[model samples]
Target chain A: MIEIKNIIKSFNESTIVNNVSTTFLKGKTNLIIGQSGSGKTVLLKCLLGLHTPDSGEIIYDGVSNKKMNDSSKTLLRREMGMVFQGSALFDSMTVIENVMFPLTMLSDKNDEEIREKAEIAIQRVELEKAYDKLPSELSGGMQKRVAIARAIVMNPKYLFCDEPNSGLDPRTSIIIDKLIQEITKEFNITTIINSHDMNSVMEIGEKIIFLVDGEKNWEGTNKEIFKTTNQSVTDFVYSSELLKKVKKYL
Target chain B: MFYLSDIGKYFIMIKMSFFKPSKWKVLRKLIFKEINDLIIESIPIVAILSFFIGAVISIQTALNLSSPFISKSLIGFATRQSVILEFAPTFMSIIMAGKVGSYITSSIGTMRVTEQIDALEVMGINPLNYLVFPKIVALLFYPFVITISMFVAIFGGFLAMTFAGVPSEAYISGIQMEFEPYHIVYAYIKTFLFAIILATVPSYHGFYMKGGALEVGKASTLSFVWTSIIIIVVNFIITQLLLS
Candidate 1:
């Protein structure tokens, strides 16, 4: 489990993530949902240690980020995995090589052992046929799967996905969402996804934190989201006409 | 002020790149790959350009030394001196600043735009150590390329003189005249320094670059410009310090 306490981040004089605190439970898909420019990415970057918060503590299990030195932080990062929005696979590397990269760099395992592990992760993502294909040869959905395989090959304690569904079709988005949820459950990892996709929010958001501007405006489950009377939440959750019709039925 | 901060950042980047080095095994593979990419692949262009330029320099020298009073060997001597002292080292490096420098920038900039650098950081790897250090190691062999350039260029000069009906013996003797070995040393020193600039300045631009595909192109242009400018400036300074 990861606990955020009073995290405040700013750029220039304007705050991007105000003193927002939340708990992301282990073995659950924790979603941070907000509109564009609403601090979702900023908050996610803070969690990933890509951006340092001006004030507050992010405690991984019991260790606060403030207490960890650079090496310690790096060590901690080894236990974490990230799937970027663009699926950030190394363009020059093939699927299996991409998945095997972290192991090749960080693991003490022999080549055969590393290959076996990478093959297992590839199989898990159902991308065995694409083992030798470069990222450019893969489709959008296949690329995201490769990214997921690479992220999970290390068996991280924490998983972070930054808009994993962006640019993907609706069907592919759901599959990616379900895959992440399943991975979170199977690994019992603390999975935090930064997204604005309402479908993802409803499908895999076991714990949802809603941000308006830089502050948390609402916190609830998907079921709770539909029933909540909060004006801003309703306005966002049912912003679309199709969603409004669905909410009317609900 | 922006330049000052960027300069400071460049130093800091170099410092950090040496920190927390990657595993030697992985770095070994990366170094070999970079050597193949940056050095071996560049040989054809260097050889071709040197040959043509050397031929031109010899031909020009031969035409200018048509006076019966001037020794015909002076044409070969002038060509050899010009090739070794300035042309091979300075001109070739300026050309590489366009070729190799832009390549390093665009490749790394593409990585940045695509977030591959971020991915490395997330994996607890030092992106600089993983990416830049190998390039530096690979380019340490750059003098090998320069040496080839020097030999091919002198050979082109020899061939050009012979084909132009100049006495081959006179040209060969001229090339052997007053060979100050220190000039070769000075040229190599410049070559080595240019190699470092070729690797680092482009890397700095690429690594720190922001934005998308268009920005990557912009960074490549910027890197090439900066690299060429630095090479020329450094060449002037080294020439003044050593030759003068």
Candidate 2:
């Protein structure tokens, strides 16, 4: 579980992440849905300890990220995994090497063990054939899958994904989203996703947090999200053309 | 002038960079992960640079020795001294500044632009300590190697001159006559310091880079400029102190 309380982040004179607060539930896909520049990414970064909140506290499990020592922060990180927006696979590494990076960096596992674990993680994502391929050799969807495998190979207690479906086609995006949902439930990990895609929300957003200009405007389950009529949330949800067509039927 | 806020951030970043050595594990991972890149990415350029430098320095020393008053046998000795005292260290740093500095800057800058640096931080990795330290360590790892490589290169130039029917014995004698412990020591000290600066400056520029590919190019350019200017200026200071 993760708790963020009254986090404020600013650049120059402008406040980027205003006094926002929310909790990401364990064993569920907690989706933070917002438009670009809505500060969802910033909030996620704050939670990840990438950007220090100007004021407020983020608790990973029970440890306050703002107050932890370097070792503690690193220890916390070893328990967390991230699938980056661009896949961000180590370009120089082979697919297996990419999957095994966390093990190599964080675990005391031997090379054989690391390789075996990495292969399993890669295979779980159905990327067995691509183990020898570089990230550049993979399609957008495959890269995301590899990134997902890398993230989970460590069996992290927390998994963070930033726009994992951003560049992929609709079918692949659904597959990636469902994969994240299944992984979160199976591992019983606290998974947080910063996403704007409605299809993902409908498919895997167990608990949805709508962020508008850095504030948490609405919080509900995916099923309740459609029924509750928060104007800003509705406007945001319908603003997408795909969601607009979905809205006409409702 | 940049804002005071930027200055403050710079100071904080610097503090984190030097004092936070606990991320040595991350540094090790970065080094091992990219070893091939560091070695393979750099060789062809190093070969071309060292070859040209060796040939040119030897030729220059030979041309200067055309006066009959100076024994022709001194040319080799002079070339060796020149390479050790100046070319092997200073010019090597310059070549490394071009190759390594730009590479570090562009690579780190690219990481920054692409948010991979952010990803590291999200994983609670110290971006600088993780990324920059390995490069700094690599510079430390290979400075002596590069110096030796440059030495071999300059010696090759001597061989070229001799094989080309220009007198070669004079050059070898010239190197022997001028060879001194103090001179070699001084060059080595200068070289070690240059290597440290050469590693740090571009990484610093690259770490703070913003925007897209254009910013990466700018950072790369700045790395070269800063590394070059600092190397030359430091060379002068070291020269003055050593001479004094």
Candidate 3:
């Protein structure tokens, strides 16, 4: 589990994440949902240690991120996995090589052992045939799968994804969402996903945190999301006509 | 002030690149790959440019020395001095500031924009050591390339002088006359210095770059400009210190 306390991040006199605190539970798909400029990405970055919050503490498992030394922070980062928005696989490496990169760089495993683990991760993502192909050769969905394979190849304890469903087709988005959900359960890892996609929220958001203007507006599950009477949550969630109809039925 | 900040950042980046690598095996592979990409792949252009520049220098010297009292051997002497002292080491690096420098900037800038560097960072890999160290090691071959350029350039000068009816004996004697071996050593020293500049300046620009695809292009351009400027400035300083 990850706990954030009074996290406040500002840039050039403007606070991007303002006194937002939340807990992300283990073995569940935790989602951060907000429109652009609402600080979902910034809050996620703060959790990842990519951005430093002006105040408050991020407790990963039990250790405070701010209190750790450089070596300790490095060790902590090694235990974390992140999937970038663009599926940022090394363009020069093949799919399998991309998956094997962390193992080669950080693990003491021999070549054969590394290759075996990489192959298993690739297969886990159902991308067996793409092992030899470059990222550019794969479709968007396949690239995301390759990114997912790379992230899990290290067997991280915490997994964070930034907009895993963006730019993907609806069907592929659902597949990726389910894959992340299954992986979370299988590994019992603390997983946090940042997205503005409502379909994804309803599909796999076992726990969701809604943000408005850098502050938490609501926190609930998918079922609770439908019943919430918060005006801003309703305004954002029911902005679409299809979701409005779905809400009418709900 | 922007440049001052960049200089400070560049030094910090160089300092960071000296950290212990995550894995020597991975870094070894990266070094070999970078040598192939940055050195071997660049041979053809360097060779072609060096040869042509040598020929032009020989012909131009011969023309300028048209006075009957001037010795024809001076054509070869002038070509040798110019090629070794400035052309092969300094001028060629300026060209590389365009060729290899822009490539380094754009490649790393693309990685920055693509979030590949972020991925490395997330995995507990120092992007500086992972990305810049290999290029720095690969450019250890920069002096090697310059040595080849010097040889080919002098040979091309010999060919051009003889083909243009300058007396072969005089030209050969001119090249041999007053040939200081230390000049070659000085040139190599300059080449090594230029190599560091070539690897680091562009890398600093690329690694710290912000924004998207358009910014990548802009960073490449800026990298070339800064690299060329620094190379020339260093050349003047080295010449004053070593030769004066």
Off by over 4 Å in 2: B1-67, B127-129, B141-167
Q: What C-alpha lDDT, on a 0 to 100 scale, does residue A1 get in candidate 3?
A: 94
CAPRI tier for the interface of model 1:
high
Q: Which ten residues in a row have the lowest lDDT in candidate 3 chain B?
A: B18-27
Estimate, for each residue in A44-65, the C-alpha lDDT of model 2 and write its tens digit.
Answer: 8877777788999899888787
Each model's lDDT comes to 0.94, 0.81, 0.93
> Who is ahead in lDDT, 1 or 2?
1
Tens-digit lDDT track of model 1 for B1-244: 9999999999888888888889999999999999999999999999999999999999999888879999999988998999998898889998998889999999999999999999999999999999899998889999999999998998999999888898999989999999999999999999999999999999999999999999999999999999989999999999899888
Binned by DockQ into CAPRI classes (incorrect, acceptable, medium, high), candidate 2 is acceptable
lDDT of 1 by residue, A1-250 (tens): 9999999999999999998999999999999998899999999989889899999999999999999999999999999999999999999999999999999999999999999999999999999999999999999999999999999999999999999999999999999999999999999999999999999998998999999999999998988988899998889888899997886776
Worst 10 residues of 1 chain A by lDDT: A241-250
- Candidate 1's fnat? 0.86
User: Higher-TM-score candidate among 1 and 2?
Assistant: 1
After aligning candidate 1 to the native by TM-score, how far in Å is the CA of B209 from where it should be?
A: 0.5
- Could you report the DockQ of all the candidates, in the order they appear? 0.88, 0.48, 0.87
